[model samples]
Target: MSVSHLIKHSAITTGILSLASFGLAASPSQAVSVDFSSWDKLGDVYTQPGEASLSNDNANFQDDSPQASGYYNLSGNNPEEASPNPNLQDFLGLDAESLDDDGQAYEGSAIKSVITAQAGDKLSFEWRFSTNETSNKDFGFFLVNNNVIKLADFTNALQSGTSGSFQTNTGFNTFSYTFNSAGTYNLGFGVVDVGDYVTSSALDVKNGNLEEVPEPTTIVGSLILVSAGLLERSRKKARK
Candidate 1:
């Protein structure tokens, strides 16, 4: 190959490499569409009409301020009125027979939302669990497609505060999940009264997000095609 042709080929390869580097370094992450108003109630009774709420203020647990938050509670005026939630039981891997009297009746409240994500996409959010229950059985948890991912047991909570009659934990914990395949998923958060339904427990969730991740193989494949096209052009010019 002539000197000029070699120079052109080198320039093309250099430009392609630079573009690939930039793309890998600065790939933009997209904002996930979370409809705060579209969250569906998952459990049976909510204690009161407004026990579950959507808001931007940090009034619930005095934790981090969020763009928007969905809160669910297991406390109310009447503790006996609280009923066992079958869906929550399913998520916890417990059966109706296991949640009988003898101070083991489990009641819970939760909110769920449907979201679409691509393979390798990441979903993340901040959650806080607050309760006045002295028993360690009462806890907070999250679910993906009705399957429990993590349980925030009362014994694990290191922080403590007060929110009305209930003792609160003002610390917010972050949770993240990466989808293995592209599809729609149901994401949910809730608080459960494990032993008895006397004391109230609440869950606060905020800043829900999903980020699209670019595959490295895809980027490499495009670079290979560009390199091939540029080399072909260089060969044709050399022939001339």
Candidate 2:
């Protein structure tokens, strides 16, 4: 081939390689599905440690760690003495207003699995309420991303929960998180508010679940380059 033709071919090949790289980056991240339903509650299974502070009457029934009960925990919580939301019972329409009513066990919740998603990727949750409250129980869910839950990020990523005491309650709350796809994150249950953050070694987290995005103009430029790559390739092949 002539020098000019060789140059043209070389440039086209480089462009193709560049476009493929961008496409791969734009692709979604791989996901890891974990199960902890059968995980055991690692503590004084029979004893309600935080009972007195939150409510001395906590767990009127079985309170062993759910892991001991033969189930995987999608999520779990071990509060440092905060009482189980009494509203959970009130919302149940049951006569009892708290888990303390029937004398149950207080098995700490568990997190069975984790998911890794990229920025702009929408990750959702399905909350299964296991509360015994038949009257006024209200449960909430929150996304603990890198341990940050400000109003801006919280509302942007996952459902924003109300802190403090609210008269309303629900069977379950489901929401989505718009991951920046940065460091790893752990999803937690229980009082999902500013103060609900708990530390645990057993929980699973996939790094880069919330990566921040490039500036708006940069993304637009990348898209334009991708489009141009496609158009140029088509033209060159047609002429060939």
Candidate 3:
């Protein structure tokens, strides 16, 4: 093919890629949130990028056992009790928990998905971590990026009771993070048990959302405009 033909083809390909990156081409003002109302359905959340499985494990849902009110109970005994084999903090390459706590013992699950958003976009969710096994134990949410643990900005403090208290009436505690660039992000929500014992904590989360910013579209448009200009120049040169 001639150089002009190649330029035209390239421009067309780029424009299609730009549209694909936008996912649903939602208005910049709208934000997408994931929530669960019943054990059977999780609104707008998935385990994988393209698949529709909502729960990573079948035992994660506790609508009847704990009267969960549509929340996940991140317990250690989902499939079976964790052996407390390895200290989770060490396994995750994080500093050890405060010495006053039980050793690193993690028995939990995390839900992951490839979330699309632009630079400056904000993604957030609400969670409650409760454990009666305080005295140096906790659970938290981790945001994984590119297979690495990027942030652990939200974790619960040690509680004084065995029964976890759900803040459903007044709303759960909110955790938010902002994206610095536009692309696919490996977003994750997890719950963990930080001590060695059968006593487990619970991580109840709801209302996950991605608040998109409009800047990425502007960038894509500029690229298309430049590509169109180049294509025009190529056509003029070929005709001469």
Candidate 4:
């Protein structure tokens, strides 16, 4: 082949290769679908009308660092309805009768959503737990299919600056869980005033996501096949 023909063929090959690489690199990964609209107040948890909120503003809670898009807030306060959720009390291992006898109330605010996920799917979220009751056993919690997971408690949380009415706060933390079996799950986030209802506690959650684990071997194999086909087509065009 002449030098000019060699240069033209080489340029075409380089261009096609670059395009193939870009296509593979720029491909979006699969994300598990989360129905944000499905979020609703958990069973009969005691809360005022404005206690549960979904908003984009984190500054309202004095969080200097905000998260992407929006966040869910569940704040517990003095029982407005006095109707504590038995399910939540059971989850917390609190005796409702004993609490009532002691003049203490178990007030909670929680939001729950039903999600369908496959095995190996990972769910994650960023959360901050804040509270005003330093002496009481206020806490923040997360649940997967009724299995309670404690996020933070009054004793464990750091003495950071106030969050809304809460005098103490815990900085943003991350929680992630991988599904072990393919099925539907109930996801929950909440805060509760354990010993006293006089003070309040809040849980803030943002960037909730469920994502499918990528199979590197399969993805790489498919990309290779696609690149090979592209290269073959380019070779045929160059010949013409």
Q: Each candidate's root-mean-square deviation in Å?
A: 9.1, 13.7, 11.8, 10.8
Rank by TM-score (best first):
1, 4, 3, 2
**lDDT: which is higher, 2 or 3?**
3
Worst ten-residue run, lDDT, model 4?
A: 63-72
TM values, all candidates: 0.61, 0.34, 0.47, 0.57
Show how many residue pairs clash in every candidate, following the order shown: 0, 58, 3, 0
lDDT per residue for candidate 4 within 86-133, as digits (tens), equals: 554554334444224223445565667678887888987777777655
Show where candidate 4 strays beyond 4 Å. 1-28, 32-38, 42-105, 162-164, 215-240
Candidate 3 lDDT over residue span 1-240, tens digit each: 687577776776677567556644323456876543222222222332222222112244443344442343322224222233333333333343321133453444445556677788887766655443424343445554633332221134433333444322222467788888878776554445445433334445666777877655665656666667766676676677
lDDT (0 to 1) per candidate: 0.57, 0.32, 0.46, 0.56
Model 2 Cα lDDT, one tens digit per residue, 1-240: 556666766676676566556543343234333232332222211212211001111222222232232122222223223235423222222222222312221223222124454456555443322222223222322335323221111212232224421112232334456766544445433321122222111111122223334444455456656767766765676568
Residue runs of model 1 more than 4 Å from their true location after superposition:
1-4, 7-27, 42-105, 163-165, 215-240
Q: After aligning candidate 4 to the native by TM-score, how far in Å is the CA of 57 from where it should be?
A: 20
Output the better candidate (1/4) by TM-score. 1
Greater-lDDT candidate between 2 and 4: 4
**Candidate 2 Cα errors over 4 Å, as ranges:** 1-31, 36-80, 83-122, 130-138, 143-174, 191-240
